[model samples]
Target chain A: MLKFNPRNYLKVTNGAVLLRAEIEKKMDEVSKKEFKNLFLIGSGGSIAIMYPFEYIWNSTSSIPAYAEIASEFMLQSHKQFDENSVVILSSLSGTTEETVEAAQYCKERGATTIGLVGEMDTPLANIVDYPIANYAENDYAADSINLQMYMIIFRLMHNNGEFAQYEQFVSELEKMPENLISVKEQTEEKAKEFADKYKDEDYHMLIGSGTAWGRTYAYSMCVLEEMQWIRTKSVHAAEFFHGTIELVERDTSIILLKGEDATRPLAERVERFAEKYTDKLTIFDTQDYTLDGISPEFRQYFPPLVLGSLLQRVSVHLENKRNHSLDKRRYYRTVAY
Target chain B: MLKFNPRNYLKVTNGAVLLRAEIEKKMDEVSKKEFKNLFLIGSGGSIAIMYPFEYIWNSTSSIPAYAEIASEFMLQSHKQFDENSVVILSSLSGTTEETVEAAQYCKERGATTIGLVGEMDTPLANIVDYPIANYAENDYAADSINLQMYMIIFRLMHNNGEFAQYEQFVSELEKMPENLISVKEQTEEKAKEFADKYKDEDYHMLIGSGTAWGRTYAYSMCVLEEMQWIRTKSVHAAEFFHGTIELVERDTSIILLKGEDATRPLAERVERFAEKYTDKLTIFDTQDYTLDGISPEFRQYFPPLVLGSLLQRVSVHLENKRNHSLDKRRYYRTVAY
Candidate 1:
């Protein structure tokens, strides 16, 4: 009777939505400044959410944008910072040690720091100069606010549509919460099916390429690694083509994230690759027109974001099916220097 | 009948050795400032071989290093370079479009460049400012030469170390060619044992961590993917604790590169992990008692390069068993921005 209950995760997901909306409003209202660059600090899911924003922002602004998993930069060279730099710090529970240390380092070096999180009362929220609360209270994979906040940031970035139309998109986002609930249900059902079949799989390899490739990085390290205690590895699909693809044979259950963007073709290729080995290929296509003409907002960003949320639910569900409790001790552990 | 032949690979291996020796001598003569940072660039095996050198150099001198496959970097950010960088480009065939473009990009940007290759007159060798020929005419995994050149570079990094001891190591290296012939026989036998059990495996997962992790990265990408055309994935062992390890099943094959280094202990942990799912596990330990007694070259600088060569040999032998020809082409279509 190991049914997956995402009650704890749901509350944080709700909080993250609120926090992200607030931060987007704040960033938008601020006086526009001519700046040389934008720097972001957050690793794992927190930073990954920034990718869509970075991609959108880089297209519009002349300012150069750079980011590193806060822990990764700390390992190598240390660059001096100043007040003019715009720095964003994000964490779901708001307690990742690396994010906190990076925040402190940036603050000490006089960088204008903005913190985003699902938790309102955590030390990270208290210490950061500009704290935007996603309002999450507990630590659970289902409660991850990374995507919720990321969607808001991406929506805001779309405000300056160098790529496509935005008015309809913004209006659609206003209705996303209700629409998202339905998507979540479908995702949960699919996850349940997957968990039933693959629950005993002791090692999992999640592979994707391009922007989604980084998704593998975080999922392997954060979700599958942290929550499930499963042996997992994520790699870019093209890199996968380099040598590892040779090991693919029947019996390898692979999950491929089919990004609806330019990376869609690569996903398709990987799906074909998996077929060569076995039929146990899970290909997530974000463009299924099942809802066909759904709200304008739901159509644009909801595809991948909805899929991502579902994948999160699936991972947790799989963990539950295995009869393992979610462990968040590492989440609370002091971010190692 | 299509049979895997080592004759072509052997010729390339010889060429790689001479090419590596030339690069070694050239590096010794190059001005220190010109060699500011050792930028190792290539795809697959070339990139894999340089990991040990990067690890070793970073061991002593705080001289910074960056190692990346040319194709991956070219797809995204290319602005991380400046005029003062020293680019060390490696390609077994003196082809590989990405390395060629990277070398060209470096030359155009006023960076001193060096080429390590299997052929003297190949396009890659012609494009670089200093091209060192390994004399490896055939591009089939530049086996012996890859390690030989790496050892020379490792020695060069320790030029400031005790010369008397360095000379002794050189004497040992002179003996290494013969040593490798024996090691080749040993690894060949081991590869046969592994292939007998797992060559028909539909899925294989290889795991390593930290410095040694690069070999797994390279092997999974180059040897396993390119040569075997099998679905393979490599992962950091530390990350296994996070989540993906759950994919391991009674059917999946797991290979652990249990080298005798700090990360060796990590192999045992991974072994325990593999046992949780199935008893199908293999550990390859570089039982180098002599390596321990030798003057400690920085792990970062030495291990990957040394281990890379050894691993390349193993991979080539495995490819031989898999009945795949190692004729490399299609270098990810690299073009300069």
Candidate 2:
């Protein structure tokens, strides 16, 4: 597990999961407000993490949800967003310039904002109406924020009478920190082979559908491009047929992150096509792991988290094989834009 | 212009404009229904074309709108869509497999469907409740559908009392066909220079914001990648700051599609950053054209159409300079998936 520590992963994830009671309490309190819709706002990986919840809300709940990029959200003046809207914003550093500005903008409009941050008293934490803090660094932040948001979003659904199985769902989510370790161990060999085989591959296509699409997007941008300076195109499985399919060559790497949602068939369609066209197809299906305590119906909702955890293993392996520091940056935060 | 006919452009666009009176009548009849939200469903370029209206609905109208990939939307069972939802589906051929299937799926759900197609008797046109027909080829379909959609969407807004300037806006839109020819004539030199300069380039970064984002995405995927076999990354201007900015180098080609919307500043920010990092920055600003008979306030809403018309000039040049036929397809519709 190149440069990995299981104990720290468990502790940080558990810290996020352990906030269930507090999250539920806050949701119960906020449920009394006349909020009409939910706005999930962030930037980069933080915003990408919100895409699955947006999908969940749209497919399973009657409530409307918008997952918007923070900088664009500010000037767009979304007509559905108002004083009665509930905005969920996340920034691990609590100092992402655009995210903090968005929080202040929402607060100025009298919207109730919930902040998920790495520590208390940061600008985002201070500006939001409800701040939930947990300590996690760059590598662990996506996993951590994802764990917290599941509680916050589902609790809102539960309070709204849209989800009756919240209690059981949270219990399964609580067991994830333990199960995630098994996923990493299981992925180690394949991940190592991938890192070694494609160390110098110039381009890769990462595809996914439903809940897995967010992680596919986040991994390509936040991890591959930002962390290792690798070039990648992350397309939704359905979108793959549009224009990207023509670019596939026999040796082109097509990585599919398959989830167990209703949209799995979409990814399956890509799998069937990719299997015929490219020999370098790699699939990381959530169904491969039983996920010990998670129920069959519930596993569909957890692929983003599962994919996120498994991809961390790939990132570590790539870092070692490519001799690239995941922390190295050519321009981001190196100088002001 | 190479391989372009101005008279046919005006005729095709004027035919779409002629539908305004009829489109308004249909909108009036449908507005009487108990629909609650909008479902914009399409595939590939058609779906990419819907992005701007989604932004328009969110920013300018209070009604909820969901723009989804036709194939994925059929499988996801979006809870927001029901008998009371209004769906808009478009396909140039009107036989696009996924789009036709999506129309059938929405029909089964009893949602009101409006189909914009190249002809009136195609499967999609037959499936939808309201079929708007215009004779348009691949090169002219985007412009035609955009003109028709402006009538359809704003009529809904006008009927909902959200837009009081509908009369003024539509009058300006009616004048677009002739004005569009002017844009083509104006863009000819620059478009040729761009196509000549970038004909041998392997990749491009197409950036846009607000109403112009859809054209940026469509040109990158539908024209550059699919039509010319060139690779491109179509990123929103705001999202560019998050991860894609790190990929910019002195030689990187950054093409910005600047629209006149509230999000213009966001694009400006990217322009500032790209100007500093890339020697190759191509900007297509809607403001460059003085659209006669159009009010200042109404011009902001027409960037998608303006950019669409302007990009046609670029596409024609690319086809000639790159020696690739725009009508040639390597996989799409040529073989079974």
Candidate 3:
């Protein structure tokens, strides 16, 4: 890996995974209190990262879950959110202003607040009732937060009697850090080739369905646009047919992210369409990556984490090939609005 | 008004409003029956149109509401949907494949299905339990659908005791067709100027908050990308500061859909930022249009409809200025994928 530190990545991710017991204890305490619903709140990539869990929670559990952008959520006056609501908020920097404000708002409303952050003692961490902290760099924050989220979300599900296989699932999740390392190593060459081939392409469309949709959205907006300053549109695979499909010319770049889930067929439909219409279609299928010791039944839940890890490699290669620093930004936190 | 037919637009929209008596009767009947939640299902622009109502419902009522992409909803097997669910679906053609399939799926699940469509004889109209039909063209469908949605959604909210001002609100809605004509007439020159100025621009970033977000997403994907083959990324105003703001430059085209809602301040924040960084900033504020008979208390609910009507003028001019037919499509319904 060009800029990736494998040892530090494992250390951070393992630390996140090691928080399982504490996370489970916290969730159990919250579960003992009768909560009505779950509000997954964050901003930008953090909010995108929650979408998969919202999808999973909606499909697998009777509890309703909403993934909302923090600032909008605060202003919307969501009627479903009340004293009994449970809120899960994530901020990698632990200093995202809107996220910190949302945490305080949730706390003031007497909602049980859970914060996922990259460091302790930060504003968000300080305000939230249950703060899960792990040290991670910008490159590895996704892996760390995702690892913690699995423990937190599934534990809540398990406590709710919705998931009976939580123990087995977490055991498989325990193997993910090493498996994800393999994913990076396996994807590095293809990522480099994709970067080299599309370095000069001005625009791209990224499509994903089910759990991979968040990664598709975040990678396009957060990495490609924000980091490399490239133009991109991320559409859901199911939505590609509605309006976006008409934009698919033979030379247009289309990226499809295929995950192992019930909505896999939606991505396949896009694949079939893109194959017929476009010459520059790239498919990143999680099924192609072998998670050596993971169970087949659990593969569906790993796409968000897998795709996040793999896309980091793509981001690194894109930055290297385009000679654009991933940290470069014209307005975000650099200039006041 | 370029290619707009005023009499037909009024006739179609008034017919939708005429359905108010029958729609209220149907909603009253359903209100007597017990339902758990709302599933607003559609595809493409149809799905995008449902988002505002979902936001409104979530903010105003305790009953949960979900705006789901039709195909993805069918595949996700959402646990919230069941016999107790009230499903609202819209398809102008009444034969959009995914929407039809979703209606069938909902019907099979024993959910109460409501279909809004252009004609009464199509598959969706035939399949749904309550079919509300009105004649509308591609350009005017937004107006027609939005008028009926106001009736249906507000009736539901009123029945839930969440909105006590339904009578006043619908009275104001009854005035919308003529008022929207004023909106189109008022916005024609500005729309033409915008189309002329941005005709050569290859890409644009559309931003909106609250109710306007749906219009932002739909106009960018449906009209600009699908109809004119221009590239666009429609981001929420609050989310703009998070990642996409980094893409803004002096020449970057930024279209802000400003609506008078609780989330208006979020859009204002984006405006402050975009004005500082981008010279090509376009703000379409619903407040600019005057609804002659509408009450001040009801202005918050008109943005979706007002913005829709105003943006239709923009679409007409964009098509004329770009020398592209809105109906022209290389893949959509022209050939098999």
Preferred candidate (DockQ higher): 2 or 3 = 3
TM-score of chain B of each: 0.79, 0.98, 0.99
Q: TM-score for each prediction?
A: 0.65, 0.98, 0.99
lDDT score, candidate 2, position A283: 96
In order of TM-score, best first, we have 3, 2, 1
lDDT at residue B34 of model 2 (Cα atoms): 51
Question: What stretches of model 2 exceed 4 Å from their correct place?
Answer: none
Candidate with maximal lDDT: 3
Categorize the docking of model 3: high
Question: First chain TM-score in every candidate?
Answer: 0.80, 0.98, 0.99
lDDT of 2 by residue, B72-175 (tens): 78778888899999999998788988888999999999999999989988998999999989998767888899999999999999899999999989988999
lDDT of 1 by residue, A1-337 (tens): 1333445444555545544456556666432433334677666566655554454344344344555446434443333235656677777667877688888877776766677766577767776767776554443332344444444445445543332544454444444444455555667767788889888875555776544554656666666666675655466665555554544557666778755444445567677767766667776555653443355334534444555655666766876788776664332232321
lDDT of 3 by residue, B1-337 (tens): 6998999989989988999899999999878776889999887789889999999899899999999998889889999999999999988889988889999999999999999989999999999999999999877888899899999999988998989999989988889999999999999999999999999999999999899989999999988999998899989998877778888889999999999989999999988888888899999999888899998878888889999999999989988998999899988878986
True contacts kept of 2: 0.66
Q: State which docking tier applies to candidate 1.
A: incorrect
